[model samples]
Target: MSSFSIRLYKDSDYEVVRGLFARGNLEHSHMAFRHAISVTRNWLFTLVMFLIPLCVTGSVILSILAVVIALSIIWICSRYVYSYYVDQCLSDDMLNIQKYYLQRDGYGFWVAESGGEVVGAVAAVPSSYSSEDKHTELKRLTVARSHRGKGIAKALCRTVIEFARNRGSDAVVLQTSLPQVDAWKLYEKMGFRKTLIIRESSLRYRIVDFVHFRYQYDLLANKLL
Candidate 1:
């Protein structure tokens, strides 16, 4: 089994953490692209476009154009969604860690290290969307692909939860998209229950947020364990 240690984020760990976040998000985007291609509706649409043009005019160019257009749309939408997450990370968390997390009360940032290398990261921050003072948001949970399956992610998550519990937080909440299926499973295993599903109406987010689930773990209820 691979062993690692989790600790509060240090200034020197910034670059490694940022790279892990970017790499993990890109992996999810690739998975989402494959899932989109496999969807029945998309397959049906492609079939219709290819057949209709061939039946009406017997033109190979139209058939090729149909496939190209379908793929182009998917590619463009996926790139836009990926870029949005990257921008959010740079603008919000990675840019000013001290202001966004360290200096604030009831907020924390952590990283996992193995063999003197940063391999994973997680953060807990005050939730602006929640009305309750005791609620904290878990953000930016990620593990390097090569180091995954060795409990690094679970360790990082527990570190954040313990921090929240120590800070007198009543609950911890997080939002994740469908593409992150493994993360969803991990949160559920860690005693987080689905609180809501948010469907974005904006054109740019619609493709990515077809189903975004919000999960919450009650620190008070599971404190003894």
Candidate 2:
């Protein structure tokens, strides 16, 4: 904390906070889980709607109306279900950071210039989120879009991992999406390996994106040096 001087996020930094969450890794597991629940709910709703209507209505025109109603029910319920979990968990990184600081389970770093304007940001969350051994999820890593390719992302990543190590984490893990091809590459250079390859989609995202590998190092072993 002394090296970077971290503090809880203030209300005024909402926009920057939003960008941080928006910019973090997007996991396919989340999209896949949400979509599965949504699709299953819709299919079940359709069955109930049509089967129940059969008990009273027998006309062909009525049957067509039932089909339309089923589709509508599915769409509305899917969005509702999606919103519910998002409120419970930060499917986005920035909101997670705010929640982390608010709950005191996570930490954020805002790289600032000597004059005190923020230039980059990163966040780390508990690995219980991943259910692995003393691991931490490194997330919401971003440099301003204009500052791309200046190694700001690398610096932010280093900061977050160091923070995790200090917190006694076994290693750092991240789940990234297709939009961050460069991040995937960077993780590779930093010694992360693909731990899981989920082919199905999960929460919020719909595209066929690949979940990238996780990187790790033993801070305890290094401490002996």
Candidate 3:
């Protein structure tokens, strides 16, 4: 890293950061997680081979149990660590998702910052994802888990709605997992209705006992929205 003094972000820096957030969160992260699991399994196999010769049948059973516990711990810890990186990447990409979803529409982004770093981000497109006529799409809305429950999401969602409203959008649309009860409430408070045409896997069917919903906010018709 360069020793250059800290300075405000430039356009080039923002692009670099955006690219880093995209590639980092998605392709690289999944690949790295897979590689880590593979490598850890190989190492576990090697260690098991080394320890097998020194153990009796009962000892072997106990040793296997211990290894299973240790491996489970390692897996959980690794997943937690991965979530840190994933949050950063997802937050960054959420900003771009506004652009990607909007396509031709202007990408308006709302961010919450802390200590000179972004802690939350939300983005929106001027068009709806629903088959229904005339609705805006809330593209990617993400906040670091540490930064939740502080009205950050409310601000972000509201900002996008206003921006889309200005762009002549009639409604705001989105998809979210059922596990996020808080998010559902936020949408409801913002006048977003639970729609039925959502195409995401988690929404269309139970993805491992998970429930999902397609949410929409009518910009013109609903006063609460």
Evaluate all candidate structures by whole-model CA lDDT and list the values in order.
0.83, 0.55, 0.56
Off by over 4 Å in 1: 207-209
Tell me the lDDT of candidate 1.
Answer: 0.83
Q: Write the per-residue lDDT of candidate 3 for residues 70-176, one digit (tens) a residue.
A: 55544444444435545765565434443443354455555555555555556665454556555667754655555567676777787777777787777788876
Candidate 1 local lDDT, 28-131, one digit each (tens): 77666766667677677778878888888899899879888877776667666767788788787789875678887788998899999999999998876589
Task: For candidate 2, write residues 1-225 as lDDT tens digits.
Answer: 112233335656666655544433232234433443355555576566677667677665666678677665444444444344334445544454555554565555454221244545666667644666688777656555556576667767776677777777877888664335677788777666666654436533332222334545445554531
Worst 10 residues of 2 by lDDT: 203-212
* Candidate 1 structure, TM-score to reference: 0.92
* Candidate 2 Cα outliers beyond 4 Å, as residue runs: 1-10, 20-99, 106-116, 201-225
Among all windows of 10 consecutive residues in model 3, the one with the lowest summed lDDT is: 1-10
Ranking by lDDT: 1, 3, 2
